[model samples]
Target: MPQPYQTQAATGGGKDQEPTIIIGIDFGTNNHCSDKEKVPSAIYYNEKGEVSWGYSVPEKASPLKFEWFKLCLLDEGDIPQNLRNAAQVEAAQKSLRESNKRVVDVISDYLRELWKHTTRNIRRAIGGQLVDLSRFKVIATIPAIWPAYAQIRMLEAIEKAGILEPRIAGETILEFLSEPEAAALATINDMHTYSPTNMEAGDHFVVCDAGGGTVDVITYTVTKTDPIRVKESVKGEGKLCGATFLDEVFQTTLRRKLDKISPDAWQILEENGALSRIIHNDWENGIKPQFRNTDQHWLLQMPTSGLNRKRTHDQFRFSDIKFDAKDVQNIFKPTVAEIETLVTDQAKTTKEKYKKEPKFLVLVGGFGRQPFLYTRLDDQLNRKKDQTEKTEVLQGSGAEPWTAVCRGAVIRGLELSEDTIESTSRKPNTVVSTHHESITHGFKNDFVKPFKTMKTEFIYSTVTTPPERCDETVKRLCKVRWSSVPDFNSLPTWINPIGKVVRRINYDVKMKSNGVTLDFEVMYKNRVMASKKIGIDYTCCGSAVNQFHDSDEDSGDD
Candidate 1:
């Protein structure tokens, strides 16, 4: 069932809820984006106040591009050195720590920069009249592999990014859609629009999202055709087998080749900007996607800027560098095997539900678009006994494979609004499932404080204000009251004990009441970051009011 926004106002008898602008943000490990628009998941810094992110961050230049920054967000350690940026995330962490910032903080900063550009682009694409930030809605895509804790922290970053409306007023609703699931939604919609063969009712398929950071797999069983309904048939699976790993392999191969010539030459190549440029140019256009088997060798020309023809053997006649097919196979085999494992596992696990096996496997993501990788997956599955049937293994048809995740997310955002409209248009018994988990977040006030006989003072601060007050009583009529003076809506999420605002917070609160029901949430920084609320009710004490407690006063900075 759609989790009620718990908008305290929704219960107050809304004939119809107002609609908001919908946008989807695909925050990938290697690529971050807003709908169809994308930018790199990178940040660059040279001095204390000098920083840039995404495409703006210069590569193969004097500045620093924080590589594999998103990988550091993972809980596990033992991260491959090649994947950990040339300057290293350790240095980035150290620099950020000096400024009282953490990984999420840096990530949020990058996202904020992206958000500003996105809104501007939206206005240019549409119009300022239709593209209003005040009514913005953002849906973020997360890897299914991210545990609950990681997702919560990602949510914290998403909140800090300033796109989400922090207060609950139906003005802003933020959703977290799984990466593979979002891709699945896009696939289904495309299939519907194009009317692909056997995209029939009851068809089961798996969506494999092979992005630059992680490989995530999700299996879905379609239930409806006219409106195109599907449910996740099995728990999603993922591994750290993304396109970034291939880049790491390429780096390792280059290092080995350079080392064969002379240690000094390899060190210079690694330290200077030359190697990165060669890798970037080759991966984006050359050998990375084109390499199919181990019979061929790839030769790269080193930058000519700082080289002597004789100092570094035949390996460096100003530019010649070589790695054979065996090296390429070694680099890709492990990562490719890992992805193949995930897809196979999802298919096997979903067999009981789908009866035979998944009818199709839809691959989507930047890495998923690789022709060689797709062939490998097809071969792997075909060799398996269960996949003897002619199950289709394909990428998205209507759009580039990389855009599916974001496009699907946007479609989902639209569907959310559409569902609300459809439900409102008809009666309660219409064709809609009440047991759907379509909602992204659900808030409940699990924490309650009991009141005694005397009226107690309660201070309440919403995402929009400093603090407000109302008498504690068993029964009362209430709503979130705003100040006439109008405090800024962009208030910091947390305040110091002395009550000084530190940073700007873009958050929302949803409060509802029959007789004074205060339902809302606020974020507090603890270097860590559910949905819980506060409730107040009278506890029977007869005449001995002094013996009973007025409130369950237990709280901490979270």
Candidate 2:
């Protein structure tokens, strides 16, 4: 018979701890659910208006709501007026001020509540077949290019929610990773499962994680050995253009229309919570709205007879609004254009710089979930094809896109928590002393001096030496600006070698509004050598790049 539980002496010297069970949390705008549980991120308000949080409770007769508390923590500056009535504003402020709460706090609270519900539900559902929540480790998938402040906020939230604690009933350390990287890992795993073909390392592929809030794309080159040298891949971020932008367009169009109407009615709609509910309901119910920019007219599919459905004394109308496909396309123009620009720019750069063409663009996210969105992208990619035939878009679903990131993150968590993979994260050893703006002296001149450098102190262990070859392929967990560059010459003699031309990498890392973190790799002798970590102050936003140095002692080859 299988032992119910096994105990082994701890490898790191402490008493044996419980085996870690990794749990992935995808904190989305709509709801929070794990791959292993039915619990959702939701809450309800009672008759007296007192709020109670959990999944739908039957005895309370309260309606199911997802992300109720999370929406309360958004930066007031980022929220539109329609989303912020006087009451909501107050509630938001209250939530924001509590423990210096930030976006992650809201996410953590929502997640903690979800976990609570999961435990309860499992116990009730299957007579406690599921393990308790305390034994599980959390792996959260965050934005690709988050600001440092935002990252700290998320960390603080995780800490407060007890994800960082080792208590029996509390969560262990939270493993936060980039959502795009996680998705790429998932794709790689998927490929491994389906295609057993022998692969080589340095094989490159572009990963696109298009979700509700952002479309995160990265180019990853697999690093593996001969006969199977495809373990490692190159990854790069495209841009962030997700479903939230669509909602913004719809909301803006509606807001403009509402602005033309009487403010009193608008206020009533806003105050009564009808506006948010209507938009939310519409989006959830698959009702798309279109707008004519020139005429300022909205084409909605609503009953002409139920025009007064907002009145207190009117008969109930069965219908709401209707949106045409064209209007949907128009509203999504900006977002679509943004993605197109990114793809074109990335494809052009890869061809010119790396001499490689991406065969496919994997589109996994909530926005990518839309079939029409994929069609739009296909049209754009085909229009811009440069004898490369076509840039295919591999799309996923809304119901799964958001969660896929978390799912991928969990796999990473399990790998990390089990000590199978070592974290090669480091702090920045340099600082930027001078800032120079790119200057094009001549009109229509396409020339650009688009790179910057920083001053940092290097830390090196006696046994660890910088890679002999270019560090371009070695990935590290560092916090540098997406477009920021680091001068390899800046490394102290103790860490880097002399007289070899070092390679510099310029990337526009995708980070959440909270904070910035970079995960990059170095390529040396057909293998990864070392990884670095650098912490950036969250407030500053600028271009970041890495430079190489060759000392006089080893010069003359170039």
Candidate 1 on 2-48: residue-level lDDT in tens?
11111111223443434345566777766775445445788876677
Worst 10 residues of 2 by lDDT: 438-447
Candidate 2: list runs displaced more than 4 Å: 1-20, 28-111, 121-129, 146-153, 164-173, 195-202, 225-235, 238-240, 254-278, 287-322, 384-386, 398-558
Specify the highest-lDDT model's number: 1
Model 2, 196-272: lDDT tens digits are 45224444556666655445566655554222222113334434355656776887766655555444544555555
Candidate 1 off by > 4 Å: 1-22, 34-38, 44-47, 55-99, 123-135, 145-156, 165-173, 267-272, 306-316, 352-354, 384-388, 397-558
Assess each prediction's global lDDT (C-alpha) against the native: 0.55, 0.43
Predicted structure with the largest TM-score when compared to the true one: 1
